[model samples]
Target: MKPENPLTIGIDIDGTVTEPSSIVPLMNESFGKQLRYEDCIDYNLATVYGISDEVFADWLDKHGERLYDVAPVHGAADRVLRQWYKRHKLVYISAREARHLEVTIKWFSRYQIPYHHMDLIGSHDKLAAARKWQVDLFLEDRLENALQLAEALSIPVFLFDTPYNQGTLPRLVQRVTSWEQVDALVDQLALEKANA
Candidate 1:
């Protein structure tokens, strides 16, 4: 569905919109020391710290559908997302499987998150989707996701600052650790859309 003069906002799941980066820790605990310290999501999912790629993919196949069980990030970030829906079109893009689509959508509904679109994709190339949407701003937690979006020319990814995403911030991205910061971003984006 198209919106009338609505600002397109692309949002990432997992670390960006959710809490504790569930998939990574789950993969690490399941696969053991194989999946280590890799900031990039796809790479880590394919291999484990230079170990066997088969092991990582095998592990991902098992618990990949349980992504919705991952805990949420603290604060009223969902409130911010919902408020933005009042004025803009939010596209929730996740690197998850189709099996978890219903669960993911329910999770958002229970959290009262308002969104216009949702795409449950695998660990494939995400930049393509971001570019296809012509997203004005992207919000995510994974550094690799931010970088990919940035590289795809999707500037100004609103990152949810965390330990995993610290220090190595990209030049074209912005970070926000608190709900207040997200609120500011929502309001600013809303105003811009309204004015335009």
Candidate 2:
């Protein structure tokens, strides 16, 4: 059931809002990690760099503040977040960790993303938190999280496309190729909800 309060939007980070693919190459080059575009989901740069999870987690402990410099995602993300910020309750549910919280806020302010309730999830299991938020609509880029949330919460999830997520998405989650399509989809969803 929809919350009686204003609809809360759960927005994903990385591929959804920030240029996650862009960062992969940067991570490969800068961190000396050899991660491919496809390997980023489960293990990510840590595996590519031959760094163990413990080491990578330690690195985050040391350099967590640097994530703010992550590049923007082609202006579509900021545009959507800004529009929703004025009308609905918005929470940025990022796989990005709590250690990076300060830098995340600074980054959003620096980039003018127009979101306030930023959540740094400990686990990659987004569906667990999505249920807790009681989101009306969830926006994400991964086929896994989108489809899982769709089945679990019956919430409409918009799955932003990437080379990896292609052909693997389920029917319950709508696929969008670009941020423009995401905006249009959100608008349509808002209108439908209003009418209903």
Top-TM-score structure, candidate number:
2
Q: What's the TM for model 2?
A: 0.80
lDDT (tens digit, per residue) of candidate 1 on 1-196 = 5445677888887766676455566656665644433464343445434557776667667765665656565577687777778768788877887778788878888888878888777864678777777888888877777877886784677777765666666677778877678778767776776787
Query: Considering every candidate listed, which one attains the maximal lDDT?
Result: 2
Name the runs in model 1 displaced over 4 angstroms: 1-5, 21-52, 192-196
**Which residue pairs does candidate 1 place in steric collision?**
16-141, 34-48
The true-versus-predicted C-alpha distance at residue 122 of model 2, in Å, is 1.8
Give the distance in Å from residue 8's predicted Cα in candidate 2 to where it truly belongs.
1.9
The TM-scores of all predictions, comma-separated, are 0.76, 0.80
Residue 58's lDDT within candidate 2 is: 78
For 68-171, candidate 2 gives per-residue lDDT tens digits of 46666655677767776777788778788787777777778877788757778966788777777778888887777887888888878888766556656556
